[model samples]
Target chain A: MRIFGLRKNTMQEELKHNGLYSRSRQALLLLACFLLITFLASFCLGRYGVPLDELIKIILSKLFPIEQSWTSQMETVVFNIRLPRILMACLVGCCLSVAGVSYQGVFQNPMAAPDILGASSGAAFGAALAILNSASNRMITVSAFIFSLITVCIVYFIGQRAPGHRVVNLILAGIMVSSLFSAGTSYIKLVADPTNQLPEITYWLMGSLSGTRMSSIGFVIIPMLLGLIPLFLLRWQLNVLTLGDDEARTMGINTNLLRFVIIICSTLITAASVSVSGMIGWVGLVIPHLCRKIVGGNYKYLMPATIIVGATFLLIVDNFSRNLMATEIPIGILTAFIGAPFFIYLITRKEKML
Target chain B: MSLTTQNLSFSYGIHPVLSGLNFSVEPGQLVSVLGPNGVGKSTLFRCMLGLLSGYSGRIMLNGLEISSFSVRELAHRIAYIPQSHGQSFNYTVFDMVLMGTTHQFTPFASPKKRQIDAAQMALEQLGIESLSKKSFCCISGGEQQLVLIARALAQQASIFLMDEPTANLDYGNQSRVLDCVKQLSQNGYTILLSTHNPQHALFYSDTILALHGGTIAAFGVPDDVMDESLIRLLYGMEVEFMDAGKTRLIVPAQGRGDLCFVGSHR
Candidate 1:
C-alpha cells in the first residue's frame, strides 16, 4: 500500500522549502570535494615534489598503461613513499574521527574522545615494550593494537562495577585507567637505552606517519572497515543512545548491549589507527565537533561527514607537517598546535551551545 | 491497550516506594496521578514501563503480563515521556522526532523513508511542522515538550506514561500541554500522566489516582475522588474548593489572621 507515500512527499516538500536542508547537502558535497582535493594535494606537495599533473597521470597510468615521461625515481617517490603515507593518514584520520563521534554519543558527553578509555596510552606502552625487546615493526603494531583493546576492556569492566551514574562512573574509571597506563608508558621510557631505543620510543609517543609502509596499511584497513561499517549503518541508533540510558531503554533499545558493541567497535578503530600512525590525538575529539557545526548534530549525516572531514583535515595537516620545514615534524604535534586554537575559537564563538 | 496493576509493591533495599497499589485504566481514558514530592508517582510510572524490576505484582497490558513482554513488545504497546530536559547535543527538531522510530527498525538498520514520513506526520499532527528545521535546543520549553509529545506520537503506541510532562513549563505552556493530553484521550489514546497540581487533574482527567504514603489513597472519577479532605490528606495542607461555574478551583484555606491586606501608598 502507498499509505506513507503522501506524507513522505509532503516531508520532502517541507524539507526543500527549509534552507538548512539544502545548505547541509551542499556542505556535505563541499566536504567530499575538499577531501578529494586535499588528498591529491597531499600526494603532489611532499618534499620530493611531483606536480599535480604528473600525480594524476601516474594514478591514471596504474589503471591504463601509458608511457611514463617522468623519471623512475619520481615514480618511486610518488608510489612508494608518499602514496602509502597519504593513505595511512586518511585511514587513521577516518578511524579516530568516527571513534570519537561514537564515544561522544555513547557517553552523551561532547568532550569525550577515543582516549577516554586509555586506548592511546595503553597502545603507546605496548609499542614501547615491543621496541625495547627489538621486535619487528609489524610486531610493534600488533602489540599496540592488542594492548589498546585490553585497556578499554579493563576500563569498561571497572566502570560497570561502580554503583550509580553509569556515565560518570565510566568517565572516572577511564581517567584512572588512563593515568595508570600513562605511568607505565613513562616507566618504559625511563628504562630504555638513552641513545637509540629512548629516541624511538619518544618519537613513537609523539606520533608520526614518517615510516608508513604499504604493509602496515593493510593491517589497519580491515579492522577500520569492520569497525566503521556498523557505526555507519547504526548511526540512527546512536541518536537514540544520546538521549540517556533510561529513555533509550524505554525506546526499545538494549542500551547495555548497544553500548558494549559501540565501545568494542570504537576501540578497534582507535587501536588500529594508533598502531599504524602512533599517538595522533585531538582528531577524534575535535573533528566531530567541527562536523557538528556543518551538519547540525544528526548522527545519520554527522557520522559520514566526520569521516570525510577528518580524513581531509589530517591530510592537510600532514602536508603542512612535511613541507613546512627541512625536518619532517610529527603530525601529532602539528594537529595539537592547530586543533587547540581552533577548538578554543569554536567554544568562544558558540559558548551558549556548548 | 488497557493497563492494569493489581497489588503492586516495590522497595529499594530497606525503603519501600510503592505498596499494594491497585489501578486499572481503560482504553481512551485520561488518568492523572496526583501526589506530593517523593510520593512514588515517578516510581510507579517507571514500574509501569518495566524500567524497574523486582516489583511484586501483576501488571498487565491488554491482559498480557508486562513481565512476559520483551522490551521491544512493551515499547510497541506503551511509550514513556519523561520530563523534558536539555540534551547534550543540538539535534534538529526533525532528528529529535525521528528517534521515536528506533523501535521499528533493526539495530543495524537506519530509519527508512517510511519512518521519516511517520516523524514528519507526527510533527504535522502536533502542528509544529514549521519547527522541523529548527534546533531542538533552541526551542522554548513549551515547544520542546510538544516536540517530545510528537516523538511519542511517532512511536505509534496506544498507551503513554508521562512523568510530570508539564512540570517545568509556564502557565500557557502547561495549558497547551494539558489540552494536547485531553485531545489525545478524546482520540482514543490511553494516557497516564503524573502531576503535583490537583487542578489539572480536576479539569482534564477522566479519572484521578492519588498516591499517598506508598499506597493508592484515592482512585475513581475526578469528581468522586477529589475533595478538600483528600487534598489535605495528600499534601498535609488544608484547602477550600471554590465553584467556578461548571468547574471547581482549589485554594489554600486561610487560618485565623492569616489573610491580611497590605495597602500601597503609591
Candidate 2:
C-alpha cells in the first residue's frame, strides 16, 4: 500500500515541483511587465503627448542636473500634473484592491468589496454637502474622508451589536447605513442650486482623477502607507481569517482582534482612496478576482499580485477615460463598464476556480 | 497527555446542553463518545479545545487547568478536526495543511521552509502526499476528511479532538478512517471522537462514553458499557447479539408474530 501510494506520490511531486512556483513566477513577471508598460503609456499618451525618450529624460533630470532639452510646459505637465496623477492612480488602485481582498477574507464572502461598509455612499454624501456649501477642494476631500470613516465605524458597531452570524449581520448593517447616507446625498443634491452645484455634485459622485493635485498627494500617501503596510505584514493572518472564526480560534489566532485591526486598516486605505478619487468602483471588486486567476488563492502571492495588477488595471482604465472621448469620462464609469462584463464572464466560466 | 473534565456544564439561556459531565482519557487511548443527536458531544469537544467559554468545570490537561493555558499554548497541545465542509476559496491541499503550522509562526511572518517541510511530512504520514497539488474543494469527501486529519497531524499535538470525523463517509471510507484512528492510538496519540454509530465504538474504541439526557449514561470499556439494554435505551430500538465465528454481530430484534415464509414449500 505504501509503495503504491509512493508511486503515485512521485507523479504528484513532479507536477507540484514543476507547476506551482514556475507558473506563479511567470505570472508575476508578466504582471510586472504589464505595469511598466501601462505606466509609460499613461505618461506619454495624454493630450500634451510627451515622447517616450523625452519622458525618460525628464524623469532622469529630476534626480540629476541633466540638460533641459524639453520645454518648461512639458516639464510642468510631467512633474507638476501628470506624474502626481499617475502616482495617485497607482496608490488609489492599490488601496481599493487590498481593502477588497481583506474584506472578502474577513467576511468569507465572494461578493464582498471595500465599499460594503458604506464608505462610498457616505463619502459621496459628504462631498455633496461640501459642494452645496461652496467648500474648497481641500475641505471637500477632508469632509469626504471623515464621513467615510464615520460610516464604517457606525456599520461596524451596529453589526457587532446585532445577533446571528457576524458576517451576515455586518452585511445587513452595511446595507442599512449605505442606504441612509445615499438618501442624505440625494437630499443634498435636491436642495443645491441646479445650475451651479448640481453638475459638480454629479461629477464627484461619478468619480474622476481631474482634481488630483501634488498638494493632495501628501495627505493620501501617509494614510495609504499606514494602512497598506500593516495589511501586507498581516497577509498570513488574513489567510487564517478566511478559514472562518471558529477554525482560526482553534489555530490560536485572536480572531476578534485580528478582525478589528484588519477592518481599521482596510477602512483607512479605502477612505483615503475615495477622498482623492471620488467613489471609483470595480477596481476593488474585480482586480482581486483577476489576481486570484493569475496567482491562485494563497494570500502570500495573492496580496502582492492584487497590488500590482490593481495599479496597472486602474492606470490603463484611466488612460481610456481621458483619451477615449473628447470630454473626459469619469473613471468610475469606465471601471464599471469594463469590470461588470469581465465579472460576468468569470462567473459564467465553467472552471469557477474561486 | 491526559485530559480530565470535572463538573463541566453549559447552557444556552434557558436550555441546557451539557450538565455536570465528568470524564478523563488516559494517554494513547482511543475513546469514542457515543450519543444521540443534539446531546452536546460537539459542544463538549469545543469546551475541551477552549473554543467555548462560560462552562462551569475544571478541564485539566496533564494535571494543569485548561483555563490557565493561552490560546497558543492550547493549540500546541491539542489539535481540533472540525467536520469537513466546502470552502469559499479553493486552496490547494498543501496550503490547507500548512495552516496547521500557524501557531508556530511569528506574527507578520509567512510559513518558513521548515514549516512547509513539516506540512509535507504530515501528508506523507497519512499517505496523502499525492493529493498535495489538488484543489481542496474539488477532492472527494473522504479525501477531504483525510486532508483535515493531515492538517491536525501537522499541528504536532499529542491530543486530538474530532467531531464526527466519519459522519458523511461510506462504509469502506468509514473503516479506513477508523483504521487510521486505531493506528494513531497505537503510536501513543490520545484521541477523542464523537459518533452516532455504536458499532464503530464497539470495533475501534477502547473506551465508550454514552451520553443521554444531558449527562453520561454509561462510561467504561466497550464491553461493559455497550450492552443490549443500553443500546435499546439510547436509540429506542430492541437488538440482539449473535456470534459469528469469534466476533459478535448486532442485529435488530423482530416481533415473534411478524415472521412469514413466501418461498416454495420444501
Which of the numbered candidates is closest to the native, going by highest DockQ?
1
Q: Evaluate candidate 1 and give its CAPRI docking class based on DockQ.
A: medium
Which residue runs of candidate 1 sit more than 4 Å off their true CA positions? Answer: A1-20, B256-266
Can you list each candidate's DockQ? Answer: 0.62, 0.49
lDDT of 1 by residue, B1-266 (tens): 78999999999999999999888999999999999899898889888898898899889988889989888778888898878889989888988888988899888888776777788888889899899889888999999999999999988899999988988999999999999989999999999999989999999999999999999899999989899989989988788999999889998888834433455343
What lDDT would each prediction earn against the true structure?
0.89, 0.88
Q: lDDT at A126 for candidate 2?
A: 88
lDDT of 2 at B151: 91
Model 2 Cα lDDT, one tens digit per residue, B1-266: 99999999988788999999999999999999988898899888888999888889789999999989888788899999888888988788988998998988776888876667678878989999889888898898888889998998888889999889898898888888889989998999999999988878888898999999889999989877788998887888778977776555778787834443556364
lDDT of 1 at A67: 82
| CAPRI category for model 2 | medium
- lDDT (10s digit) by residue, model 2, range A189-307: 99999999999999998889985888999988998999999999999888888999888888878888999999999999999999989979988889989888888888988898999
Pairs of residues at least 3 apart in sequence or in different chains that clash in candidate 2: none
TM-score of chain B of each: 0.95, 0.94
| Candidate 2 deviant stretches above 4 angstroms | A1-19, B256-266
**Candidate 1 lDDT, tens digit per residue, A1-354?**
486987567677556445546777788999999898888888778667788888888889989998898878888998889989999889999999999999999999898999998899889989999999889899999999999988988999989998998878888988999899889888988999998999999899889988888988888899999999988888888999999988898888988899988988999999999997898989998999999988879887899899999999898888888889999899999999988997788768846774
